[model samples]
Target: MPLYDYQCSRCGEFRAFRPMRDSQLPQACPECDVLCERTLSAPFLSGASDGCLSRPQGAAPGGSWRKMCGFGCSGAGCH
Candidate 1:
């Protein structure tokens, strides 16, 4: 199972744990029980410095690092 971020029109944003088989299925908001749609999320790094993600891998200025996942996968999806 994987945790997915969802946003409901009536409610707001929430996360749910669902199996891959149920990914396409509509999710109900925990607060309002309304159908919620999945939303794109960025990867999170615990204990990372504030500017690490925005900075280049090297110490050079105006440098850019390779993007881990252009598709924007997070958590277990990253591996």
Candidate 2:
């Protein structure tokens, strides 16, 4: 199962874990009980990587590199 984001017109946004086969199907809003459509949102990729590290050219200073790069870090390459 994968977590998918959904948006309800009356209740705003929420997440649900479901099968990929049912990704296109509408999900019930947990708050309003409305059948909301799936929304296209960025996937959460914390600690996910392809064994490559590419630093941003002009990234702002003073933030978690793991958050900025979406990869786990050991306090290296982060200022």
Candidate 3:
């Protein structure tokens, strides 16, 4: 099962776990019981720093691998 985000007009947004087959189906809001549509959301990367996804790779001003990748990379096998 994968977690997805849904938005209800009355109750705002919420997350739910469902199979991929049901991803396109509308989900009932837990708070208001109203059918809500699935919303587009970005994947959350654990331990990732802010701006990691916003910037292109190797585009950091300082050119540090850690800052460029936002992963505090150790330079081992890193391009």
TM-score of each: 0.51, 0.56, 0.55
Q: Write the per-residue lDDT of candidate 3 for residues 1-79, one digit (tens) a residue.
A: 5667677676565666779999999998766688999988875444633322222433433233234443443343333
Stretches off by above 4 angstroms in model 1 are 43-79
Tens digits of per-residue lDDT, candidate 1, 1-79, equal 4666676675455566679899878898765677877777764333322222222233333222224322233322233
Which runs in model 2 stand beyond 4 Å of their true positions?
A: 47-79
Q: What is the lDDT of candidate 1?
A: 0.51
Q: Could you give me the TM-score of model 2 versus the true structure?
A: 0.56
Worst 10 residues of 2 by lDDT: 48-57
For candidate 3, give the lDDT. 0.58
Clashing pairs in 1: none
Residue 34, model 2: lDDT of 81
lDDT by residue for model 2 over 1-79, one digit each (tens)?
A: 5767676776555567789999999998765678989888787565443432323345443332344544343334433
* Order of models, best lDDT first: 2, 3, 1
lDDT scores of the candidates, listed in order: 0.51, 0.59, 0.58
